[model samples]
Target: MARSLLPAPDARGPFSPGFWRSPLRGTWFTSVLGVVLLAGVTVLFVTGLLSYAAYNPDLSPVNDKTPDKGILGFYLFSWPTDPPWLYRLTQGVHVTLGLALVPVLLAKLWSVVPRLFTLPPARSLTHALERISLLLLVGGALFEFVTGILNVQLDYVFPGSFYPLHFYGAWVFFGAFLAHAVLKAPVAFRNLRRMREGGEERADGQADELAAPRPDPPTVSRRGALGLVGGGSLLLLATSAGRSFDGPLRQTAVLTPHGGPEPGGGPNGFQINKTAAYAGIRADETGEEAWRLAVTGRSGTVRLSRADLLGLPLHSAALPIACVEGWSTSDQWWRGVRLRDLAALVGHDGPVDVFVESLQRRGAFRHAALRANQVGDPRSLLALSVNGEELTPDHGHPARIIVPAAPGVLNTKWVARLTFGAL
Candidate 1:
């Protein structure tokens, strides 16, 4: 047999080919995991982009989180308001699938870790480039996954804002991910085909750098290893996917922060991301005698009290509140005045962008801007009540904004003003 260029087994540490003792450490195993991630991460990237666009990031200085997105924003479009549950489904899949893929990602990394300690690091220019790409692929994956999990849990301990950090990190990570996938896809497919044709031993025989010179005795078959990874993924999915739903299934979402019985109870009880007190809502301000809504447009500013808003034509819609954090509420009976009606009162007779302001004293998204499509949706409302009861102080007592297919934060609790026109 031709002598391998890699260091002999007598060498110490990971630089020795014999140091990697797992019989499972071979090209076929790594290739299989790579193929699965190639398809999964692609879907994850696309849905993540869709989630960003749903925020109307084009509304600069208002709803835009990554203000300097530049060319990255090229694919952004006015997110549709139809289907009503569009954002809910996309974001739900994005978060849930992301968590479920953790085991596969970790296993893929383990299968290829020996490469990181290769002696001499690079044998040629092509080899050097491949090593560099691999480094970026691994580092970027870790950063994106860690930061994303923390964000979903509402942990902001990391440096920089979550929006911009995650946005830019995704672009860099996916760029390297695509490059690596393109370079290795042909070999991976070949390995998969060899295994499928009962040529598994032949495929293992042709193992490249991933094969250990002196592997340990096999404790489990390759198929068994894959089964273990898949089982772990399914376990995570069962515990995390329920946060996006309602009823008993929600209890299964023990992995999520908002999972378990609904917070509090009764008609007014559902889920409140931030309470009125937490938002600095004073008792005197939200009271019917004190609260007033300011509507502005071509007709100029017109202030209306809560009673006056009630006197206007009332409408109702069953809408859900879906947050970027991945937790969502079931459809609740919401009663209030239509956003279009409010726009008309301010002289905007047709679909036009609207800027919404809230009385929130702390935190991000105290105000938000909605696109014309969102404003045109007749289901959008300045909700004054839910489940047929008056709004609780925590639920935006006087009124709140509820736009179909919009993010939960953009719903703008404790709404104080509505400006109908180009945002």
Candidate 2:
């Protein structure tokens, strides 16, 4: 049997007769595939971090009133408070890249699987670290992709809470990813430079080795494998992207539960996660007579019923309510008092973080912290009506907080009280 000309140590560096026999396993092939996978992973990681910041804002002391204190959510800087489409783009990339990565990851894994059985396994400390890094990259990638796919699908098949598991695991995965990138940089750069220079040509004997006698080598050619992988990425993107850009692609996004036009019809027509009935809230209980929106801060306390709230200055904003769940509403009209104006009544003129409370007695996101940017935005509102109609019970009846560039959960539905400082 002929062998590969590519230099290597002994067992699995690169020059193996068996490895050369598979046309798809060529060094050039592996290098190119690896680059694609790398790009996808890097994009996912960055967008993932941005999404985390949008949710956790770890660096801010503003979240003192909330639960889950000091959880590694230490991301400082409030996310953008304008261009309401901010998270739509970031989280959309995160989820779509996650879906698109499935095939690329599978291909990269398939190509590298043979190395796992290399005898002696560890030739030196660096080799051992390389193996450890590989394990982390594999395990972390699989765990994250699997959990992400399932989580976005709303499947809770995992043993524990998806939030903490996914969150902490990301840090580990990213650390390992960085270490692996540093380790592989040398080989990767050389291989890439060779490919770009048209130096991808193999030596005389190497190409012949692929045609040598071998036991059932892969019949699929390199181009075929890449085509399959690319096809898969395109297919997944087609089926998932509509949740963000719900237009002509909506029909293709069958996998996305929230991807179609607002199903409720008219003003109320839109995707809903938690329904009023499911939330154990009754129509009778939410009557305006019983409903009151309270505003409190450093200045004083003010209770405003629906009529009183409507009597104040009202502004309407065209904003999208984007969520971490990988879906977003089209820009809809929201009408209510400007949050900063509301804050001004409470003696907050300067930049300040406000604690928004909701009537939800039990739920993870009942309350949220709004940073100065969100509070001060003219578009941020104690929204009384959506699309020109009073909020439906499912849509945070009475009033809700709608801030540009804020996560839907952080928008604080069914708002009850507003405390402007550390309370």
Candidate 3:
């Protein structure tokens, strides 16, 4: 008889049987942490989809007349104007949880990192696939988190545009996540159920998976490990939540990273992402005498001076121009000609979409598209004034489009023209 000298295999099932011998590495601890991160990622995906759907770019009409290329305007649908905070809440959760996950995810990874160095990492084809799934899960998560945080900070150190890159990456990450979920579901469910039943189990009748000399006692008990993860999450929330909420955190500028003035500036105001100078808008172009809002439609084209627009029926609405950068101003006293009123100049009484062109000659968002609902909403306007006074050039000056439930960029500042057509 011959015996070979080799360390025994340390292979264990998912949730890793006898994982509790490592205390902090207990099945309950890892499963719970995984579940929280999973839930956060799931919410981010859903909210992101909702944000994309709100973009609502159209298929048929590219321009007032047949045009060369289609405008992706990305202004396809007017997200609900009611509950103006809808976008605010979803985007807020997306950013906040994303930030919070920084610590939570690190902790989960730290707890499970030992498995990465496990001897004989794979014992079979099935095990090999499982390890591959782990690779996808970790890689995808890191990519999403890092890119997402950078985006919130408006740091474009990456090679391509943030929108397309982050978007495609999301699909890849979620695909791997779904695959990994299927592989780990049974183990995860069993462990979760065991924890609920007071966690005393020899499930599947499998013996413990540790050697006689078990791994060193964990420095923290399972409950303590959970507390550490949870406490880290709470600290992140406390420090960063001020970006969305108002209070001392904002004044002191604690750990809050999303920095900008509170929405409400200008002459009696609303906070702005880009001021007039920063946007490279010339002061002369926004002058009342120099600016003429040209309105074109299926029927005809008409140009209106500032007074001409003011002479037309005027209305006011309190709307919030919520920025995706995570700031919002409510109850803005926006006064302007109803977008439908401008549409009427060309006989467009029915549902119509409006194309808003801005005076700013250069910049990424110099023009915007108004979806049908926005054009029809009485609240939608080629705003002549905000908060009872003429618009400051920085606030879209002679004329700008202020539509309900629209992103600030799509609100179309420094608006120079409006083109109308069938929905």
Candidate 4:
């Protein structure tokens, strides 16, 4: 049997490997994993923005009434107004994605660490920037992931507002990532071009000398590896799926028998009434002819009458209405027709944006416009009832918009009219 010889460390740096060392398989694995994890982060960030845009404040009364309870309730504390199913679903996705990122990031760090000691050529300012950007990228990513996980686990126990940190940190993450990509663009392009031309540039020159060219190592058989990855992703998806189904998950934090007397009827009890309100709107004492839902902007001039709306097919959903505020309530049955169906009645073939106007006309209340996608999303609806009862005057008596999985602000209340036009 032949004995294997281990390479000695460099004289200059005790830990440094020879100049022409070979890149390890772990490096390739980490690189691929890092790219995938980065893509996941981008998706999560964009989706979060979309959810924010779709938020409907009208749907969140608790937040409006008790700002502190509302603020702390949804994200951290449990409140009477929190939407049971929706909150859990969003939280699950937020936390699970956060946790999944840990190992991937760790592997990436481990892969690139060896390069730090080698001190590769930094031929220009751009090269130096690229190196620095890589470090920042790693640091920012680690910071975001670690803080995010801790925030979720600790339920955001920081002294100040975690929102400021999370929100501002996102910009930093975005900037660092953008800088890193820009810095690496030229080299990446060149590397791609080289590969296309059958020219290889090994990270370590010794790859050619020490290791004979062999068929690429099967990182698990393709099908088997894909199965494993798919299985893991599916498991995550499954964990969140329960929230969408009608079960205990569908319940909200609001106490049952809403109108029933409580220890304190003021803030602790269910303050919003559901049925009487919807009935009043249907009666239209304000005059049915006067009621108009105006469509403005790109879709051209169009108006919907009361009859036109009622004529459309009605669909009811017991979906939870989660606010960014901490409190949650569940099983507040929503009875309404889908917004998409209503839009279609107006002959909307594609996307349409519209602003919602309320009758109240005071306080934090304000009009908001919905982009085409938000208005068209299947989960968006014009609610007529709450918990199988008609809406109460205090809770958008006439009509309200309910956007599942969105924050409270986006859900417009007392939807007197919808003006479709530029804001």
Top candidate on lDDT is 1
Question: Sorted by lDDT, highest first, which candidate order results?
Answer: 1, 2, 3, 4
Go through the candidates in order and give each one's C-alpha lDDT. Answer: 0.86, 0.75, 0.69, 0.51
Candidate 1 residue lDDT tens string, 396-423: 8899988888888989999999998976
Query: Which has the higher TM-score value, candidate number 1 or candidate number 4?
Result: 1
Count steric clashes of candidate 1. Answer: 0
Cα lDDT for residue 390, model 3? Answer: 88
Candidate 1 local distance difference test against the native: 0.86
Over 8-48, each residue of candidate 2 has an lDDT whose tens digit, in order, gives 45644333445434556655666667778677788988888
Q: Looking at model 1, report the run of 10 residues with the lowest lDDT sum.
A: 1-10
Q: Pick the candidate with the highest TM-score.
A: 1
Better of 1 and 4 by lDDT: 1
Q: Against the correct fold, how does model 1 do in TM-score? A: 0.95
- Give the runs in model 4 whose Cα sits over 4 Å from its true position: 1-15, 18-27, 55-99, 118-128, 183-241, 244-332, 335-405, 408-423
TM-score for each prediction? 0.95, 0.87, 0.83, 0.46
Task: Give the range of the ten consecutive residues with the poorest summed lDDT in model 3.
Answer: 60-69
Candidates ranked, most accurate by TM-score first: 1, 2, 3, 4
**Candidate 4 on 155-214: residue-level lDDT in tens?**
566445555465555656767887755654454454445444764445434343222133
Residue 415 of model 4, lDDT score:
78
